[model samples]
Target: MMQTALQVLDREYLEARCSLVELGAAFDRVDRASDHEENAGEFNDSRLELLKQALGILTEESHLPNRAERLLLLFSDLD
Candidate 1:
């Protein structure tokens, strides 16, 4: 039997909230540290681009169930 949305939320909400807060804090730290650099170019990095893309995937609202797979492919080297 599958759990309802509220049941899942009740069990996972705190952890999920903490993870998002952690991610936000990490970005804040990066921004703060980059502020003192003359040529930070924080947004120009490929890794940052990948992270933005992953965030895009996370923010999209759709019925597709392959978000995890999409994120994995986004980070994978297909060569």
Candidate 2:
């Protein structure tokens, strides 16, 4: 049986909200730690750029599927 939108939200909202909170906290920590550093160039790391791109994908309003796969592909290029 398919769950209604509200049902899905009820079941999943807390977990999703927590995940977002955790991600935000991690970014906050990074920013705070970077502020103490002497030479933290603006997004000097490729992983940070990838993380920003992944956040962009998450924030998109056009309902696209396979977001995890898309993010995986985005991160797969380690070179």
Candidate 3:
């Protein structure tokens, strides 16, 4: 679904193409230690919140009032 969105709106929402949540998770997992790295759940949580808010704006702009509605409309034939 994300790839679909990118293919459709890549030129317009270039910034939202990457997974902001996942990128922050990766960056936050980088350890200062020699062998092991702890998951930075807090950092990733913060990023998740921010990304959720940002995603809302993108969805509104894209006119996806409720994504599930769009998905159901698109796939209702399978039912």
Candidate 4:
């Protein structure tokens, strides 16, 4: 269910959201082994996958669609 949503992001957006992209990169490094990191939960593939889902919602918004909910989703969980 979650992984499929991440893949859906590849279809909806061109450029990645800046903060989300950076957060993802940071998380990826931690995933690769770094331990001292912020947003540690983001490092898990499952969580990272969810962030992708959230980012897609933000970036694919048409002419800045309402993002208040999506922004909260970013700080919260995808499920």
Model 4 clashes, total count: 0
Cα lDDT tens digits, model 3, 1-79, are 2557657675645564466666556555542331253543323345445445554554564544666565444444564
lDDT by residue (1-79, candidate 1, tens digit) is: 9999999999999998998899889878778778768877453568877887899998898798889899999999999
Q: Kindly give the stretch of ten consecutive residues in candidate 3 with the minimal lDDT sum.
A: 31-40
Q: What TM-score would candidate 1 get against the native?
A: 0.83
RMSD of 1: 1.8
Regarding lDDT, does 1 or 3 come out ahead? Answer: 1
Quote the RMSD, in angstroms, for model 2. 2.3
lDDT of each: 0.86, 0.84, 0.51, 0.65
- RMSD for each of the candidates: 1.8, 2.3, 12.3, 11.7
| Cα-based lDDT at residue 38, candidate 2 | 86
Give the least accurate 10-residue stretch of model 4, judged by summed lDDT: 34-43
**Model 4: residue 41 alpha-carbon error in angstroms:** 16
lDDT leader: 1
Question: For each candidate, what TM-score against the reference?
Answer: 0.83, 0.80, 0.25, 0.39
TM-score leaderboard ranking: 1, 2, 4, 3
Question: Lowest-scoring 10 consecutive residues by lDDT in candidate 2?
Answer: 39-48
lDDT of 4 by residue, 1-79 (tens): 4668668788655554665578878766766663556665444567666766776776674665568666686777457
